[model samples]
Target: MMQCYGKSRVLTPTVVAAAAFALNKNRSLRTQSEEVGALDSWKKLWDTGMTRWHQRDVYWVLQKYGDDYIHKESRVLVPLCGKTVDLAYLTTKAKEVIGVEGVLQAVKEFMQENPNLQMEAVGSRNGFDCFRGEKIWLLCGNFFHFGPAVAGKFDVIWDRAAMVAINPSDREEYVQVLGSVLKPGGVLLLSGYVRPKGDVKSGPPFTLNKDQVLHLFEHQPWVASVECIESVNDAFSNEAWYKRLILRWRFGGVVSEDIWAIHSKAK
Candidate 1:
């Protein structure tokens, strides 16, 4: 059964039991060899059409929570964005939406898929191909190389798959990079997956519990507060693609989808 927990509630036993089952089953799944943070690996995924993470429409989390932070004057940044239709949706609410992607293939696909957007090649910067639309800019290059200097600070950041897609060791650096581009008082809407207490390690879509997220941002001077707004236990049940991936990977265990609202301290 699907369960959604609010900020005031603690994790239930059902969630824990499901996670245990998932981790035990995942232990038998095939080991993944791809380096998740490597640009080449992402390029290969785009080349081979292995992007199961790509959703056709705006993500539900964004649809439900976006209006609270996004406004007509807001400048939003989306990291590790992979041809998501959400970028187009964000432009409707914000003044400008900038997406940083490592793979040119993915960026090209986004442009191709949204012809009505009318994006044009603006040129290149720091080896990144830049595409400009009415209220959107796609930067095709290394996400780590992007900073506030490249495009100024953003009022909001939408991180749906960026955090979980990288290695755990790189989390601190990821947080630092995110902090560098966010304006004071800006908000980050992060969506991630969490499993029960276990050591099963295969990933591109890694597990990151609420505690880990808090610890990562706790010591950061720019951070004001980190709050878990929602948690859904049966996160992928309704998505046929997620089910197919789970079956193909022999993954067992309850994975919960968590939404975090991380706020930057005001200046």
Candidate 2:
């Protein structure tokens, strides 16, 4: 069984073995062409309906843990957000919800699909197409190019699948971009899958385990702490899209999904 750590927990070899045997196989299934940092690749994926990463509902992790940090007065930012329903859900919790996406098609689809939200074009800013609803703002442009100057700082950043999707080489730059817009004393809720040891490779959904997350953020001067709040074995096994990808990838191995709550130090 997967462990949920309110404080901290150790990962045993048995746990990894069990996860491998379960549905955690082939966690990093996207091809090199789908590298998310590349704007053209994301546009291609959205144009061709290869958006398996796009979840139909609000992410379960966010639903379960988000309330702890997100408040009615909080301003939330979702980076590299790809037409996720999570934005709609976030609009209810935070005073404002901002989603930065690279693909215009995905932005248009999000507006089209959530017509009930009444989101409409609000002109462009800094070259990004802007769409606004009551409490949600969707920016269609390069996420790396976006900063606090465009929309101001955020109290919380929800990074589900966003960090892991970037090429490992660009991770530092990605972190810088996220940190630049996050307010002092802000919280970042990050979720991603960890691959088995010694399997370093380029990936769209890269292997970003708990340890890497700690090393990436904990050492930063602005970061206060990085905590693994939740973890699950074979978390995506039941997803229909995961099942379909496994048949083609056939890269069986142990993979564990982890959710980290990284807090920025108060200035």
Candidate 2 residue pairs in clash (backbone atoms < 3 Å): none
Write down the RMSD of all candidates, one decimal each: 9.4, 9.6
lDDT of each: 0.78, 0.78
Instruction: Score residue 96 of candidate 2 by CA lDDT.
Output: 98
* Tens-digit per-residue lDDT, 1-267, candidate 2: 455556743222222221221222133344445545478877888999999878887899888888899999999999989899999999889999999998899999999998988999989998688999989999988676677668999999999899888788667667767777888899889987776554547466788876677667754656667778878877676667667766326435555688888887677
* Per-residue lDDT of model 1, residues 1-267, tens digit only: 232344432221222221232112223222333333377877888999998888887899888889998999999999999999999999899999999998888988999988888999999986678999989999987675677667889999999989989877767767877888889899989988875455327576788776788778766667777777888876667667767765535445656788888888787
Q: After superposition, how far is residue 89 of candidate 1 from its true place, in Å?
A: 0.6
RMSD of 2: 9.6
The true-versus-predicted C-alpha distance at residue 35 of model 1, in Å, is: 9.0
TM-score of each: 0.84, 0.84
